[model samples]
Target: MKSYKKIAVVLTTLGVIGVSGCKKILDQSPKANVTPDVLASAGGVVGGITGVYSDLRNLWGTEGFLYYTNLGVDETLAGGGASNGGVAFATYKNYTNNVSDVYNALGGVFNIAYQDINTLNGVLQYGVAAFPDAPTRTAYLAQAKFLRALYYFHLVQTFGSVPLHTTFINTATLSDSRAPVADVYNQIIKDLTEASAELQNKPGENGSPFAGHAATKASALYLLSKAYLTRGWSSAAQSGDFQSALTTAQTLISTKATYGVDLYQNYADAYAPANDATNKEDLFAIEHSTDTKYGDFTPGASGGKINGWAYFFRPNYPTVNANYPASGGSGVMTRDIANGRPFFRVRPNYDYVNNVAFADRSNDYRYWNTFQTTWIANTANITTPRGSLTVGTDTAIWMPPYDPGADKRASFKGVIFLPPSVAAATTGANASTNTFFPALKKFDDPNRPSVNDPSSRPVVLFRFSEIYLIAAEAAYKLNDLTTAANMINVLRTRAAYRTTGMPANAVANMQITPAQVTLDFILDERTRELYGESLRWWDLTRTQSLIRRVKLYNAEAAPNIQDFMTLRPIPQTEINLVTQGPPIPQNPGF
Candidate 1:
């Protein structure tokens, strides 16, 4: 039971020795400088393991990783604030593998992942001797293995075949080659299988060890199922991969009670800011806190460990009054913590939101639950063209799912935002622009210190609800339509509008028969349940639907996306760093 304070001190000490500015994976010399003698003690082993956890902050919550995972796919497009590096990801315009270009920023994941992998390798190598007690040693080693598997899973999924290093390097190496995708999957499965067997089953955020945010048996199982599911779609897929995935996911689903995780009854409650740290639906999350020392980055600092997920998908709501001058001086809306800082980096794809994902806005509560439709007036006595807005009582901005006719929209007191179709056709102040779409409410953090500060909320990386989706997907692949429909119905039923005036048969309306279980339907269901959560690109790629879906649903990216783009270009920096041997080749057609 080492205190978090002690671990933070060790993390700081290791951070100094391990920090490096080199962009290439092979050039991470500082990590190699971490001597084994430093990791040979029990306290050192704990610190080293905590360092691996800290590395996740660099990826899970950062803007670069967010763009890599969420943009240029069917679900999202470039928004008003996407003029920066993010627009390339969203539009796939001039997106290339060159290390000198903005796309190279995405390579941060590759570098940070290997850095953590090397650190984990050191932990596993020295942890046994550091902790002579068998149980303590096994617990520490299991967590390291789980993290290693997670890193490899992300790498393989993103870059196709990445250089695999399972041993700690004490010196920099000049030559490395990409492993076969099949080999990478094999290692991922092996590590997760071992981790799932050895790790404890405690729920997340329960005040257990590691501030109750440690990886558990459920986390390992979830990744294992995903690994199998992804591998089943890969060229290296085995005959039993889909069956293995289905069985593995079903095991976690059936035994969720023992794992101390379950889906929230209402989807909105799962993402409520107050429930963030202790949300039962979250199987694993990257922890962030207000404590500047251990909370990764300072809450409002320029850089470090801030979770910028709150910023990226938001629409520029504060500019709504500027965009429409009808709402007088005190403005109908102003920047507020509840509405989130408007980066407007990524906007939801119009077709995906309006036509595909939330087609049943009447029956599905997910449409309203997932988006912020109204902004309550925080300013006092704001006058609009139609009427006066009283503070806290009147709706200052309304972004309804459907287009209320011009006559109906003119009757509303506050500003009204129609769908992109109407906005695109309109002129002057109300004309189409990236800032006025429906703001995603899923990552909104009302608890931030100020309007512009980054969120301290732990990014929910894996959730219990995804387990059901994984099971449903695996069942669909296996042609077990009955099991697939059953698994999906559980989530759909939960997504139904449960309010009094909503349809009493909402749950029944949401339920689908086995005949309705197509690959496309499952993909749509995933968008309904997990859109803008940073899994869309992987989801689209894993199912080989990236090109087709992007063309159909994402007008901005459809013209430029190519088959070769399925696997992002292996960073050119990594290729350049191989000075001793033939340089690593870029992904085909890069």
Candidate 2:
């Protein structure tokens, strides 16, 4: 997007430099026009390194990875909600994931990650001190190292043991074996710890004119802590990883002011696009701009500025004819577009709403604030026996439990329709798309020229609130229940702020006890706070709770899920290309 002006030019430069490589970096064949010397130059290295951030944006900016990560989790489901689309991701949830589709979704993610790794290596090859100025050199190198660690962390988590590439190579190497998961964690820790020491502690662009999409000391530290926490959960994890994670998280929480990060008093304030730079809760985000006519699509073929992800979380309103015998439906559910295009790619599960959000609906504000239960009519296109529905004011559709059935179309005021019920009588074959569920409203972007146009809202990658969760989880693992409960209470108290009509101690009433400090409890807490974010799948996998949770929460994914479903299939292309050295093995049970 136009917002990050410094890196905008570098994105185009990547194409000119011909960042062309084989399936992986094994075949290092960049364009000859771009010699090593040119790349080694201070200016060239800076420009080349900017491309890596673009890759980050491309990787997380769209619905592809989000679909893979959030869909199969207990909180959300993949597939058309009251319509049809997103079947590929449904494959993952249903445990029917094959090499071709899984490869396409996650395979593409792997290639992009290495592409980023290669870019970072190219910059590191020249050495950080090579840059003209001392401060600039340190910043650049730190950013590259931070990203390298992040890429590897994602790889190791998603594919288990993966090919680890640290340095830039000028020649082709036929085979690369999967490094030990422990080895990958070591590298990640080394990179992050080093990066955090050298990076700045400045706040990112919440909405400032200055560039806001770079790594910071806090960002690196937070991720380092998270990395430690994730590694601690591994089968071959080392001793004291939980303590290490706890210490790091404690450092982050205690040093918030020094790091230029603090939890937002209001949850909605954290996501407001207009205040990206000013939002202290945001430690790092993929900054985007609405300046482009189409929106920033550099991260991938699509982005928040193009077919933005906001629409994917919508419900198929007009397509879902809840009003039978049309006492006249809200003229084809026109108002659904006001919430943005309804790709209806992802919908929250019933239990996520009823058991979690609605469990404390009186005291907790997250349920109402995070979801859209009502949708008004934006246009009038259909007619029935009743008078024509008015636009903007008439209720077009309403979600179930709130839907007021018996075909009262003329008087229907609530505007959103829910997906099919989880019960067998209604769930039937189209259960995936036929039910009524509240759509996620967190990514709302009404500025798009059309439903297909992407919103330019910056996709937040990390924030301060999650740090609390991390600390709580790490503490729970270490049996430090006091610290765990306190960390969780911070968020609970914040959420209770929305209990305006409820009791003064409603939020305080939401706090958990030491006895409630189980892994499942923490996971459920995470769901209430970070439902739509892409962390669900990783959370489920790391806890080794995929099968248990899938069976309990996700019906579509339960039957097919197995222990091996935790790690995705290694892309067949990578396997085929590696014709030498130890036969680059695919993840077990793929």
Give the number of the best model, judged by TM-score. 1
lDDT of 1 by residue, 370-389 (tens): 88879898887677667888
TM-score per candidate: 0.91, 0.86
Error of 2 at 104 (Å): 1.1
Task: Name the best candidate (by lDDT).
Answer: 1
lDDT of 2 by residue, 230-281 (tens): 9999965889889989999899889998977887766776666556656788
Off by over 4 Å in 2: 1-10, 13-35, 81-88, 91-99, 203-210, 291-295, 298-307, 320-322, 325-330, 335-337, 380-388, 400-436, 499-502
State candidate 2's TM-score. Answer: 0.86
The superposed Cα distance between candidate 1 and the true structure at residue 308, in angstroms, equals: 1.4
Worst 10 residues of 1 by lDDT: 1-10
| Residue 143 in candidate 1, Cα distance off native in Å | 0.3
Please give the TM-score that candidate 1 achieves against the real structure.
0.91
lDDT of each: 0.77, 0.67
**Model 1 alpha-carbon drift over 4 Å, by segment:** 1-33, 97-101, 203-208, 322-330, 422-432, 497-499
Clashes of each: 0, 30
